[model samples]
Target: MDKIQHQTRPVFPFTAIVGQEEMKLALILNVIDPKIGGVMIMGDRGTGKSTTIRAIADLLPKIEVVSEDLFNSHVSDYDLMSDFVKQQLQEGVSIPSEFIKVPMVDLPLGATEDRLCGTIDIEKALNEGIKTFEPGLLAKANRGILYVDEVNLLDDHLVDILLDSAASGWNTVEREGISVRHPSRFVLVGSGNPEEGELRPQLLDRFGMHAEIRTVKDPSLRVQIVEQRSKFDSDPYSCIEEFQDTQKQLKDAIIFAQSRLHDVTIDYDLKVKISQICSILNVDGLRGDIVINRAAKAFAAYNDKHEVMIEDIKQVIILCLRHRLRKDPLDTIDSGTKVSQVVNDILG
Candidate 1:
């Protein structure tokens, strides 16, 4: 019992995962520059989408929070905390803190609006005739990752609510005649197998970047994946131990990127390239332009480079602009392939 409480369940190491370079890069760039927004992954059913995300969540650095702050708000930012907590702090009340691993919350399918965004406490309202607010998944996900699997199958109304909170960074719940608002900032991570269904365009725009994944076609790569998974299933701890140094190196690299992200700058020429690509692709709004700019800068930072290059921009073009393209009524090519061709034509 003690060990379970003190430790985390074993996860497949991010370093041990096979292929899907595009998916892995999108996830890493989000961590480096969350302002690049979140990721929307569409892929085949057995391509390890959910597993890769959960593994990245486990590999992230720990965060420090005020001892009893329910929202897990950063200690320095009082605004992220509740009014009552802020009041206590204003009165010079000493609040201790503890370091805990960053959260990775899963939003279960079929969750009610109230469950996703809290509601009036029913017991309190009935017993004491006083309304009390109950925090839900949105509150718990503050400053963390909020993952939704099979997002295409999610109800439209629920999808709207999630996107609303994500865009506004606040969850507002009015129910049982009680109104409450709280910070709900989080990185939205969603995955779906396209065979299940396609995402709505409005909802699709909410994602910052999109990537597609498929099964490994090479027989040797397939065998390596199976062997690695079998070994981990048999000895999870030992597998983790073996990957420990590699994991630390990657984690440290992410930290380095984050620290110097602001120092990484995009040149005017690269900015023009971004706009030209978006124009040729006919992406709606300016989202494609903006996401590409951010993702490219992040990619350069991840490589320990202080300036964005044409190569950095090229590497992330498909991921940043894939979902933003308005589909052609007559074109027969897949979105990813079309994006690649257009990018090469514009940038080459």
Candidate 2:
């Protein structure tokens, strides 16, 4: 039998993408701090959600990963060992190291549970009669991003699988007298149109930030977007030069932000005020406070500032905590209205 090789897929360059600055910014901020969690993009179809995510692969810097490790586990100076690896070390075997590029794996809506998680490799296990573990999408996405389109429409069982793997940062499989666990940490990126169906609140809260995108309304900008896309579709490489320059600028900014993030501090009084706002708005859970704090810090870092101000917090409050706010029972009140009321009460 001839061995089939995996094909390299092309991604649209981030810089080449048309307007959607808010969505782009949110994703970049999350990348800067995966502790900020993941980003959820809700928007209309053809609004460039998938395109923006794919483009990120080209825009961001490459990461170092363990060669042949299904999950692209990073080998850092700290050398924090995963449970599986710790056991291996305890057994007195030297672990090998080889560097490979990071990956961005897409999880399609129709993906089966067995495929998302791994099933017994029937061919290797039964046909060849060997006990071998086969990795899945979760493993491939480690130290990288996992993008899901139409996430709201995904099967509940698959969603449960994703949520479990995400929280644990590892994928464990036990079947056919084989038990294996592997690190599966990765940033989750999901995009869907709200009109289709609502995301389960639990899964929704798992996303660190949310960005809503819409079609560009400006006539000139819209035309320019269409023209640029046309040109790129015609000659991908020729259009990439201009895109590369923009991507370089973004990469440089990210590097700068990473260095400056820790230096950026938050004021005690402002932190108190942020808590008051969340409390007044009755946002559920502690995620609101955590996200607001991280967003403010990221905003300050992005601006090359040393401290987070009320203004910085205000600028990011909606993106960070808007979805978490409890809806007003009165049909007359909208989320924006609630946000504005809180902002005015605090800033006024």
Candidate 3:
């Protein structure tokens, strides 16, 4: 018990986060299908956005990575590794592995390029005058979640760097004659208060799903939130313990869903429906249609369904289409509302 206590710390339970159902579903769907790409969450301040994401960190299952690999490369991704790592593996070198929690890295708003990327090892520079590259947040976030709080406030250059890394699933550092490349596949999670600012188009369009979270407004729900939060604050350990079983169930569900997602078939009708919805919205690119199809399949997987359904597509319509809508100068309605209207006109 003593050793176990030292091994882990209590976190605010995912189940304990009250309301924001859509946001929670969005995160879960991403977990089920990271190929749906990443998620963008827009909400007001103090709305449990960060806490909910932090809660996700605790709920995730541990991953296996090649031992001594700084980038935490998965065994499956070993063949696609950098030339040096690959050569070592081909020489019958003993590659060991250990299990670790899926890394969850926070991208600070004021981070510099070097910090977001990385620099040379100090010991190598001092002892041998050799520049050995070190890993940064992108490296740490490989095969994990790269969470950016207040993403709208990030510098334009930093956002561009992040977008590029996300799109390519790799980060390469070439400055100072230290060339290093590593896989950086991560589920990008960006949350910002829209009132503060708007995300740039390039970065925003990359996200596959977007959710607008509102503060708990119902009196009963608010009371429940206050009560659960106060109880968790008073005794965090017990609170987390109470929800441990539920968290395990969700974690297992995610693992199972991932295994079965590939087999979950989509028919031609569903493809036509998704395309029709995207066509109605006049979304900029094929991303909208692709996201809708992927998010629907993910939604089905989450519900243990082996096939996509119209209801599943409807469930994720706003999340997949809200951020993809083209701006209309004369239109005053919210994008989510417009998406819903279009979905109704087409699907209903």
Candidate 4:
């Protein structure tokens, strides 16, 4: 136990992170409502993208899962359980469970589809008449966050496979006609540097929200960030302890927002206006509108409001719509600026 504890790395607290408010907001909104899909964060190197994402994971409240379940099957939610667990439950088996931190899975850039999606043991099936499915990263990420760093450097085919599973909330693997399908519901967070490469336009649109972050240009803020990181590096446990109270507060806020998200209401007029903005921007599909609605409600709930306010929509609209806009080679303005301009014109 001592060795295990020593091997585990301590995380910097989410509340202790400085600057990059937009990126933080995007992640928080997604946590409040995974149906808002997931956030695509594009930023320069060493902007704390990975650190912030990991901190968010560490800061989340624990969830109960079936004991010894490969998929982290939810203790009660049937939809969140894997096929094997569901079968066992249906057969009247009482499952033992334990609480665990929400999983944060990092997808390596070189991971293959089989490695990510798992595989079937056909020989075992033939010999023993038991379908032995090897669980993969997707199985481990169920009801959790699947993070891909430097996502732009990943193969587009693999990215598509991941997006498909994320959108469908399930992953099915087949080998020689023997198949296994499992719940794969997860918030798919992808971060990459534009200096590497850009995801295809169609692929980029699949993400629910896009947040852009930059290196701190202000000297004082940069110094502060550096100092904070230095402190964390020197003594991670003490640094995390220093912000435990704020971390609990933020975690509580997230839990409250998630519980209240469905109860939060949006006005018909607001919906119409959101669609109008999407139309004016010529967003490819209804995804932009839907994401905006979900994200706005999440923002409202996060602020402890039961009714969606324009301010709530304003806070999330750019994140939802920026990446969906058609590329304009001749246009000098960034997509975020264009989104804000349209929102102002329409909402005003």
Candidate 5:
């Protein structure tokens, strides 16, 4: 639709948000480098976990998308496009482009399997006597953010479907004598209160980084947070306008980071340091190293730097490796302290 129609949707301004710095940083890191996988936020309810994520859409710069593409595919980078579509481009067909709003699809807890994975269009199939594929939430979330709140309570089958789509960057359907596959390469974001339930380990591993959010206990900070939120709730439109300049600056920073990400280089010494820490800690899988490297690079890019440094790697290590590391057997040490120890032992 038109710009006015699109702008009607309400979004909380990122700068105006209160507390939850860790949650905000982790989410921004993912945006800077989606290959770091996605961010998982675990916290108590009403800590702004969901609000911070939803506000990300407002902070992001609009992307150039393919005209008439259901998935909002990026015209500039067709990395996730199907082989069939790629072949069409090779055959000299002109691919059109349109500037559209970036997607941020929220998958609710009450959604069903059929609604998640495309179900057979019974009406169309029966009327035409031919199987037709109806797209689902995954399809709608392509090349954007797929947010799942209360993720710990998601049904097992749906969790499997989400994991499969995330792993392969595509969703495949086979039913009623019809088969279809489409790109489903959205960044997976999940937030939930751990007291409700623990996330399945398999699904948990899909998240590249995790952050724990807690209510701010500082009296002055808490008061400021409450007052700001109350005023925004009372006059969201004017409050957002007041914060528009800050939002624009953040949007520019993200755009600049995305452009510089490719040019950013990591030194071999820093890579070795990253590997040494993960190896020393006996962390499983090479994914930790990959995430650490990507997170560091993104951090450097966010700072408008061309080279990754030990400081950047160290800054994000807790968020990057916290969820991946096994629990200490002693149970006496805090995770942050343990992480710091590992960093100090290696980097010092």
Candidate 6:
């Protein structure tokens, strides 16, 4: 059987993406610290959500992984290695490593549970007296990003599966008492239009951050965006060339931030203020406070700072806590506004 290969296409440079700063910041922070969990991007259609997400792959540095490993297992990080690779290591096998672009996988809305999580080859177990496992999107997304467009429209069960693997950093498949498990750690990025529907609050809270974007209302920015698209459509390579320097700068920043993330620290007063805001807002869990701290540290690292400040927390607090606020069917105030008000009251 012939293998199917993906054709590489020109992605719009992340630096060239106009507006939507919140979405961009959220994505970048997650790259620096995937422990912030992942970003849930809710925006209008044609707002370049997918374009911005895909651009992330090209904007970052490559990763070291075991060559030919389906799970993109890291060479030395036992936490990131797949079960198969771990077994190979335990048996004293030499594992070759290679540098590859960080993976970015798109999850189709119509995909099945088996297609998302994987399938166990029960037939092989019966006929060949051996069990084989088929890797799925989760496996491909290991050590990278998994993006789901129109995520609100995805099946609840499938959403649960993605969230579980994303939260646990592993995927397990069991069939006929045969089981296969692999490390599935990756940034889970979900984008959807709120007009279509909304994820249940419980499911929504699972996301680390929520970024809401809208159609660019500034006329000048709109014109600039349109002209940029026209130029890219006319000459993809030259367009990419135009932003190559900036892309490299952004990539360098991400790599450096990742290396220095652990060095960045947040103050106890800021932590107290963050929790106070969450408490005042009646947030359901500690996730809101924790995400804010991690995101602030990531933002500080990205900015070449050794410590997180009130400013860093201020920048991320809204994104981290907005969606976690208890839903008020009758309240007409924007969630971000509410978060900001609490920030001002507590942090000031």
RMSD of each: 2.4, 4.7, 2.3, 1.9, 2.7, 3.4
lDDT of each: 0.86, 0.77, 0.84, 0.92, 0.82, 0.91
Candidate 1 wrong stretches, greater than 4 Å? 1-6, 122-131
Per-model TM-score, in order, reads 0.94, 0.87, 0.93, 0.97, 0.92, 0.96
Report residue 75 deviation for candidate 5 (angstroms): 2.5
For each of the candidates, give the backbone clash count. 0, 0, 0, 0, 0, 0
Instruction: Give the per-residue lDDT digits (tens) of candidate 3, residues 36-146.
Output: 888899998888998898888778888888887888877657633544567677897777888998888999988999888877676676679886887789988888899
Which digits, one per residue and each the tens of the lDDT, describe model 1 over residues 295-320? 99899999999999989998998898
Off by over 4 Å in 5: 1-6, 82-95, 122-131, 328-330
Tens digit of lDDT per residue, candidate 4, span 205-324? 999999999999999999999999999899777777788789999999999989888899999999999999999999998999999999999999999999998999999999999999
In terms of lDDT, which candidate is strongest?
4
Query: Which ten residues in a row are the worst by lDDT in model 4?
Result: 1-10
**Residue-level lDDT tens digits of model 6 in 283-325:** 9979888899999999999999999988888899999998998
Worst 10 residues of 2 by lDDT: 1-10
The lDDT, on a scale of 0 to 1, for candidate 3 is 0.84
Candidate 2 stretches greater than 4 Å from native: 1-10, 77-99, 120-131, 176-178
Off by over 4 Å in 3: 1-4, 79-84, 120-131, 176-178
Ranking by lDDT: 4, 6, 1, 3, 5, 2
> What tens digits encode model 2's per-residue C-alpha lDDT throughout 1-348?
011112154456787777898788888887776667778899999988988888875567776654455556665422323455566557876677775545778998789877787766756877787767667898787777888899999997787778677666778888866666777777788899999997887778778888888888899998998998888788666667656667789888887887889888998888888888889888788888888898889888988899998788877888887677665577587675678688879866
Error of 3 at 313 (Å): 0.5
- Candidate 5 lDDT tens digits, 1-348: 233234676677999987787788888888987788888899988888877888996678777777777667655566667544667688988988788666888898999987887777767776897767778899888878899999889987887888778767888877766677878987789888989987866567678888898888999999998898888788777778888889989888988998899999999988998999999877788888998899999999999999988788888998887777676577787666777899988887
TM-score of 5: 0.92
lDDT at residue 27 of model 1 (Cα atoms): 95
